[model samples]
Target chain A: MSLSVKHLLGIKELNLQDIEQIFQTADNFKKVLQRPIKKVPTLRDTTVANIFFENSTRTRLSFELAEKRLGADVVNFAASNSSVSKGETLIDTVNNILAMKVDMVVMRHSASGAPWFLAQHIDASIINAGDGINEHPTQALLDAFSMRERIGELKGKRITIIGDIMHSRVALSNIYCLAKLGAEVTVSGPPTLIPKHIASLGVKVEYNVKKALEWCDVANVLRIQLERQHKPLFSTLREYALYYGVNKSMLDSIKKKIVIMHPGPINRGVEINSDVADSKQSIILDQVENGVAIRMAVIYLLSGKREME
Target chain B: MKTLLNSGQLNITLQRLSHQLVENHLTFNDTVIIGIQPRGILLSDRIVKMVKKISGNQQLEYGKLDITFYRDDVASRDIQVPNDTNIPFSIEGKNVVLIDDVLHTGRTIRAAMDALLDFGRPKKVELLVLVDRRFSRELPVQPDYSGHTVDTILTQKVVVFWNEKDGKDEVILIDKL
Candidate 1:
């Protein structure tokens, strides 16, 4: 039922049926995850390489665990300790690993389109963990997975993605995924942080945070890219908090019980306040739990031996 | 095409199987009924209903398992949409009856057994099938209890319809044209 793609480069490449198929596969793996023994021998005959050029904790560990749980032999390689430190090209690094018989690769690189570039030249199936500000396909998959778990079918549901959109791979991937699934997606943040010509991608850009929150059934507050900022995007952190930070008082003002979501490493008091992030309506933890299942589905689907009916 | 068993014959076969289960396991304290997911669940549900009616007790443990991830031919065949697995209790030291609608290449049963071992080690595991498509098993596996055995060719397929969803219980064999 999956689309015939060797690499999961971005959500831009997936259609509605591919997304549905991955969700359906994730649903099967979710049942396996809940069992007393969460390991399956589906990929025992295969091996994987997790190559992370960017610093990450959650995505890396989730992919590693997902690969192991599927019974695949996994080898992790971070840029700092790998041949990349010696100035090796991306293709060279990946090809070296593939020479050892690695069947698949899960890569997280700082440059946008890095996974796509490697996928074209490499023999192994490439999964984009996060490719700079371009896309994080698995994150988007888990986000949609969590949303479907809480809100059921996404068709016609209003989803408001908040915070820094221009620098968020999560937002980009989510916009592609949610829009394709028939959801009315809107992006809101500082005017400068919002990308140019985003409306062409089929989403409304609302500058007012309150109006965006009011219009949405689910509000996904992404972490502001403090590290990626070279010049100040806003006047100050306090100024950003005043206009964008979602606090208890701000949330309490709204009568509707809206689901709150954040792609972690949450910057408390920056994009959203502590109370709101830890609130009963928050599904950050559920997103993390579903992350493993999403990665499992991605890996299982992209395995070299894709059997088509 | 030929009908191996119609509604009346199907019900009698399931009832007889349930009685045989009761005669062997007695109170069923150490027994658990597990159905292969998707189609086998309908047959398993019918069996559970018959057993509960005959014993006047609804305490027997029953569950459904999907073997999609455990299948040996996953990489070589079309990927199947997996159903749900709902086992609330452990199979440790228990007698397990693994049920399915048909016994084809015996691969499905083999995959089910592999999945079952992950939950816990059972004292023994048995197989029950509505249609035993003989002479085509690819593995060294056999059913302990069977409703009926059909002699089939390589080019033919066996389709089982149940009253629970198909409006009536029936088994029909078809040849590939």
Candidate 2:
């Protein structure tokens, strides 16, 4: 079966079936990656443009690699070096790219809901990479995939998202995704770093790191977005590390081992200790590997929508 | 609709095909059996079983190949979900028998062969089919061991049903109109 939506704008627009379809597709792509000849000719006739208004390493490269692996012609656009700096409008920039015969767009922007706005004005399908404090759908998907690989089914599994809940697009998307999969989610961090009224999203809030770590099966520690903060939210990185950081000793104190995860560019000793991030329980690297597969699945499913039209 | 081969005839043809395979690849020491995905798997599964039984070599190499990624008409048709490609053993320097239920356009075999080469270079490759739609082939490809052969028009279709999937073992030719 195909995905319900044409564009993967956000997890909020996805039903449970869409998520399952993507996971199943990714399973096939994962096997393809393990072969001697890892490339496939599925998208040989298609072209995709990757437009990043924000900076990224893992997500952008992962999307580019997925596109190349599927044999799609890719053109990369970086905002820092583009005409956006010359006061060109978003619509104008995208129209020029579309004129070049691009079939799809994978975009990350500094403004929230940028991809949604672009989707309304463009004929090409849009995949939201990350928007300002809004949602990172692919990151959430890869996180869930990694967790499902480690543990069996996500239903009734406890997932604790620790650190920078107020500023993380990943946290919002993960909450939406995990909720649809019937998983229990707990948002844990310092009081200032966590958003008020977060319980409206149907998640438990925990201010103490140790108690939160002890209560979940998976701890998806998010990076502290120092760049996103315009005002002082937390006192200091050292204080945050001392109070909210996930260290090996905190995990060792728990009765059973819990799966550890991070969407990278990790603030090594700040949100997660070096030892904890590299420990046996950590699946940070697996999340990166699955990112390529997940992006491939998303791109392939979206490209199939073209034939239906 | 017309019945080409009933359950009794299907059984005899499968047995004969298996014997023919054993005669060529004695003990299957260097030969690997691979089933093309979707429908070809049904014929290949039975043929593989019989070949193993006749040769008395339970460890014979076998795999299932899905050519969806290598297909040339991906964007022009419906989205085809890929089946599992489980070629655990390398096909390098080995003989590979590509088995299918029907050989019609020869386009699928072309795609299947391209998919097979990605694993490793095989010494020799051959086609095995349950039914050969003789004159309908768009390409110059033929099966090495065929159970049955029929001349058909382009508008007609050849369908094989297995008890495991279709609740019977039979071959049927259907007129489109």
Q: Pick the TM-score winner.
A: 2
Cα lDDT for residue A49, candidate 2: 97
The CAPRI class of candidate 1 is: medium
First chain TM-score, candidate 1: 0.97
List DockQ, one per candidate, in order.
0.50, 0.62
Q: Deviation in angstroms for A200 in model 1?
A: 1.7
RMSD for each of the candidates: 2.2, 1.3
For each candidate in the order shown, give its overall lDDT on alpha carbons. 0.89, 0.94
Real A-B contacts recovered, model 2? 0.47
Among all candidates shown, the one with the greatest DockQ: 2
Model 2 residue B33 CA deviation (Å) reads 0.4
Q: How close is candidate 1 to the true structure, as a TM-score?
A: 0.94
Q: Name the lDDT of candidate 2.
A: 0.94
i-RMS values of the candidates, in order? 2.5, 1.4
TM-scores for all candidates: the values are 0.94, 0.98
Tens-digit lDDT track for model 2 on A235-295?
A: 8899999999999888999999999999998999999999999999999999999999999
| Pairs with backbone N, CA or C atoms under 3 Å apart (clashes), candidate 1 | none
Distance from true location, Cα of B7 in model 2, Å? 0.4
